[model samples]
Target: MKYKVTQETELLNFLLEATSKKRNDLKKALKFNQVLVNGKSESYHAFLLHAGDEVELGKKSRQDLPFPILYEDKEIIVINKPSGLVSEQTMHNKSETAFMIVNGYLKKKKEKAYLVHRLDQDTSGVMMFVKNKKLYEELTHNWNDYVLERSYQAIVEGTIKKDGRIENYLSENKMQKVYVSNKKGKKAITNYHVLKNVKGYTLLDVFIETGRKNQIRVHMSSLGHPIAGDRKYGAQTNPIRRLALHANIFAFEHPFTHKTMTFKTEMPETFYKVTGKIKK
Candidate 1:
């Protein structure tokens, strides 16, 4: 059910006035991720509902969304996020992001979703979100316990002679530049295996046990081989025209079922094309 608000009011009060459902029932629906505000899931009952805002009482039909939904259930959702899109809204850019897009799709169904993690705007591939606040809080509070493995595929400059682990302490300066430090910050661990070598680049399978911001890019650059097209870290080439990194694989146990689940996406076709053109 959908209703367009005519007067400014609080969210809960608006729902009560629009529907005959009791306040408790409306609250239950909101907690279940059933209510939507302007194509997004909003749980704040007292949130002021602006006039003309669309309010959905139940899930609506979502179709032909921009992104692909890899997986979805009552508890969580997984999708293939494209490059050049931020995972969530930032202070500077209030434009559409993965979070807003997902909510837009959900809002069509009168449902809503929550972002559980984020991927850099230039990085593409698998990402996850939670449906309800309870599951969101549970998964966030014990992240590592629930997330079993997270891996990425990166095309980097130069050749990696052998597979190895890169462990270091990473710290960020005031300029937002992250670097490896000898005496500060928290430990970051990245294990990488060389899948193959192309022309002047290496195709690497990177598994990160620690989800540090810019961990993979920093670790690979610290090894003297920045990711291809990663001008921020020091890549000398622009074969792919963007950050040559992707979050390709994610494995985890269900927060509610405790069953192991894995999600994977094919590496961007352009990556293979560029690597193929590199002469050995």
Candidate 2:
């Protein structure tokens, strides 16, 4: 269901007057992130609503998803992808994937989804897909030009005393593992700053200049501080029982509209649990 706001009011009050559902039900919807304003999820009931705003009560999709939809429109859809799911199906692996889940949801609406980019199977956070072929081609052809920022949050196994940069060439073996190689390999660069150090863990804010496969994982491992639980890169501990890396921020310009778009998700609670810091 959708509503066009005619007057300024608090979101909860506006919903109360606009919908036939009880207050408790509306509150529950807000809590579960079933409400969206102008295509973005708004969980705060006290958020101010103004005239000319588009309010949507998102009904549950037929397909069950482990992740949450952050934003969607006729042109594109963004999701906060959870860990342990492949971004898309592979030649050998035809099992469930993020693409399959989003495609299923769109199929229910008589729409189609196109792959834009990918995240590592163990990496969690913002991912996007285009709804049409034109947009897909535009983005995939000029990805670096349209993408303004890509950042991540990670909990590495050791303490990093200062901000640093890592630059090296990376190559992948037949086994699908990526390693640093200077012999005809792709150059990758990553910059990181220490966010906090708790116990034996170090939380880092990471940015990448070139999106090579496994760039961050290889770079951090070179510094002797592999991401927690990333055994593939020499991590000694599994404090979180999952890769402690997350792609938390993605900012880009819409290929068709040229409008700035940004999506972000909070670091998983398990990250804070291992770091002994509370998320605020």
**Model 2, span 1-280: residue lDDT tens:** 9999999998889999999989988976764457888887665677778999999985553345545888898989999876777889888678678899899989999999999888988888899998999889988999999998899999998789999998889999998899999859998989998888889889999999889888899899998999998999999998766799999999999977889999999877557677776444
**Tell me, what's the RMSD of every candidate?**
14.4, 10.4
* Worst lDDT 10-window in candidate 2: 58-67
lDDT of 2 at 73: 89
RMSD of 2: 10.4
Give, for candidate 1, the lowest lDDT window spanning 10 residues: 59-68
RMSD of 1: 14.4
Q: List where candidate 2 sits over 4 angstroms from the true fold.
A: 1-64, 278-280
Count of clashes, each model: 3, 0
TM-score of 2: 0.76
Model 2 global lDDT (CA atoms, 0 to 1): 0.86
Which residue segments of model 1 deviate by more than 4 Å? Answer: 1-62, 277-280
